[model samples]
Target: MTPSTAEHPQMSVEDFEDLARHAPETVTLEFINGKLEVKPVPDGDHVTIFMWLLRQCMQARPDLDLHPEQGLKVGTYRNGRARPDGALGPVGHFAGQGEWADPAGVLMVVEVTSHDSGTDRRDRVEKRDGYAEAGLPVYLLIDRDADAVVVHSAPRDGRYAEITAYAYGATVTLPAPLGITLETEGLKDYSL
Candidate 1:
């Protein structure tokens, strides 16, 4: 089963969307598992790591673009919404889809762990399950605290059938549809 608390949703999706629209730009908001989530802003280390991935991805597939902080409709039946750190897909894949875009054509989603109390549960687990359920082909989690990159792929039955963790400086290969390779060595330099 997907990670969700259907019993008591904090508010309707519409209400959350409305609130998100009016929210101050300084804060990022997300709705996952029927609960409101305030995503912590990315720190300098986090920013550098994502930019490193962006460079690698661009070099491998200039045809694709890794959009940062792209809002996506995710989770069971697309009921949940999230703004992954990066959403990689064909250039302009999200064109004209204001705010939240459907997960279709989104090859991979990225989340760089922030130094916060919720990093483990929010990024490593809940987001993983949600992206898998959304049928997103890949969910790449840069686990800063663990000093590893966790790749979640092959979604089937609302879960990733294969999960692999690679230590920093390892060569991580993102599977097909997104046939891009990553050399995580640069990640070490950004370590806090």
Candidate 2:
């Protein structure tokens, strides 16, 4: 059976943390606005693109730290936790944290669209808003469905004030703090 974006039974933060700690490693769960979202494990292409982007970020900004599947606390919602495809922050910003990093310390959040429609929607839409609302400086979205990379920045009033998009093979410049142009030359489209 294939996993879909069906919402799982809601659980408190403590319960979710306990389950997350003891659950099988195969389970990919996220708490979004008091709802437990069971996300499909990323496919190979997703991983490939993510790693490439991660490398780019590292090479461009060695001063910052990047991690894959890093959990984050967005806003004051105790039940909501976000695990971005990749998260960027100052080195050792969350060094002593427990299971999640504070959004205030995060400089950017990256999300690579999943093949699943619901998952894609969440990454492209819901997470974008959530990240902005959390006051994140940037939200980088690699949308396989649309074959484009979008950079959302300058968050204000629960949204980003600036957005720049580039199709595959085009370079997208990330504003200061990141201050780098991402090379999308080898980023694969989902259609392939």
Best by lDDT: 1
| Deviating ranges (above 4 Å) for candidate 1 | 1-4
lDDT per residue for candidate 1 within 85-120, as digits (tens), equals 999999989999999999999999999999999988
What lDDT would candidate 2 get against the real structure? 0.79
Q: Tell me the lDDT of candidate 1.
A: 0.91
lDDT value, residue 147 of candidate 2: 86
lDDT of 2 by residue, 48-93 (tens): 8988887898898888888888888763343367888988998887
Show pairs that collide, candidate 1: none
TM-score for candidate 2, residues paired by index = 0.88
Best by TM-score: 1
TM-score of every model versus the real structure: 0.96, 0.88
